[model samples]
Target: MLTRWRWFIAVAAACALPSAAQACSCERPSGDLHTQLRTARENAVAIYRARVTAVDPAAFDGKAAVEVLEVFKGPVKPGERLDLPSGGRGACTIAFKAGKEYLMYAQGKDATSVSLCSRTHSVTPGTESELAWLRTGKLPPLPVALQREAVSCEPCDIDLVGGRLIVAPDESPSSWLWPPQAAEAMKEGRPFFTRAHVDSEHSLIVGMSFDGKPFELTQTHEYAAPSACTRRIHLRWCKRLDVTTPAGSPHPVFKCIEPGESSLQCDESKGRESSWRPPESIPADACLWRTSDTALCTLEPRMRLLPAGARASPVLKCRPQDLDRRDRNHFCQVETKPGPTDKAP
Candidate 1:
């Protein structure tokens, strides 16, 4: 999930366009409010709050002329008249009605086209938040249904000491710690290491630590058995392990057991245990793991390092709205007013 968020943030930051479509399929806009705003600001050639002053009646190639009421971006000025593409039966083509107001995200320098794929839509109560954000450059508060009590896990501390990563484990319910013998071996600097579980679809590997830190590893390759293996049934089987390291680290060293065995190996060792470090290259504001699966720390909305533990309350299930939209497989945080027991210690 964190991997998905990282990828989402990168794509949202770049404001990359969706692939060209031959049919009526639109990429879903991000559920993140800020991401949506950033994408529109960066990707659209022109944007405006305007009223459709006139519309051509042609069935396939009709155009709508809008009178710009307010310009949020581009060279267009208030009250300027611009003809934009409208009324088409094909996929992603939009139809505009005269005399209606709209928030237009227009393509091209001439601002002559509007696509359903963009956020262009009729102005209504539904768009008030977006309009407010554009006008004030501040994200409006999430709707009541979208707001939720901030959830936190039990506290754990992760640090990098002497080029080696160390996690100070706590008694949190969600803590992922090595057994006592392994912990002792790690302290003694013995040759013990944990294997990372790979999620090939996401191209991610999650490595565990004796303490509680989880390393999210990226960039991986898989090798298969050679043609010689086809001649021998037993030789057809290849030993392979996907090894991953923190993004921006040096290329990982392959430490195969036998000659030609496929595996990932790292050089840095602390005591007898192998440990991976947090991404030193990432900004402090970026998310970092606090436990194997429970919580993350971020510096931006104030430095917050939640501990790893069971959730404070049963998961709150509710309908998706605004920024609270979540994929079907996941449950989003639902609105909950803070109670006295919810106060920070």
Candidate 2:
């Protein structure tokens, strides 16, 4: 009887084991590349191209520091350092190696993180379309049927389908204020003039610092659709105070005013005064001095945060037994290296 019971237990255990093929299968993701891009953008708080600059091999978690290469879809500027906290050896881990370029789609606005399940992957061939759209503010075409069906509706101030042909949602907002250093100089009464242009209800305010820093300012209103419609509606309202520059030259040149001076003369040729107002929500006395507030002021209007309820499904899940399984089923082994098909056109 004891022998019979042992045979029965062995058979039950064998039946419970998953077939090798079943353990490795993954359901293909839906949507084309553009759709995936839209989904990724909607799900990520930040996205950018960067190179891993340093890694902490001794840390308990896989931690790394990366330098920003391009400002694709984050509140980060080029040259900023991003600290990543979760990587290496988990179902959702991204094994970041030093000296590699990656197109990272990160989550969390404050403490940023990424995973293999994310749209984040190593930069490779055929990926040019996405980056091109980022640099040039161009939108790729969608399927004809989906295009024709999605028209601008009342609830959707901007229709996603029809809007893509006209608006480049990924474009960054034109800077409307000089950098802090330059602004500080102007506040101290520096004598300088700038040529300016206004377009699509937006204007570019340029200036130079006493130390030769260039100030490029842009002020524009952004609009977005409430739902899947790509057409955008007004996201925020911006304002600028009227002020004219000190006299001289044919073009409008903004000049810094003395501490007590309320106004300055403009050049007979042409002069205008422009003062970029902080967002209504920000405190008036705040200044840019080694803090994230500066980036928030710059990238918030421009950085596309994940929308209300979008999800990116993971391709793999590591079970308890799969933890140290360094073989095919191990989650950490699934690396997305750029292949020939990944090249940009």
Most accurate candidate by lDDT: 1
Candidate 1: where are CA atoms >4 Å away? Answer: 1-22, 29-31, 143-345
Q: How well is each residue in 96-215 modelled by candidate 2, as lDDT tens digits?
A: 778988878776554266754456666755355567766775644421110001112222211222222222356422222333333344566552222243221223344443333333
Candidate 2: stretches off by over 4 Å:
1-29, 58-60, 137-345
lDDT of every predicted structure (CA atoms): 0.40, 0.36
In model 2, state the lDDT of residue 177.
31
Residue-pair clashes per candidate, as listed? 9, 25
TM-score for candidate 1, please give it.
0.37
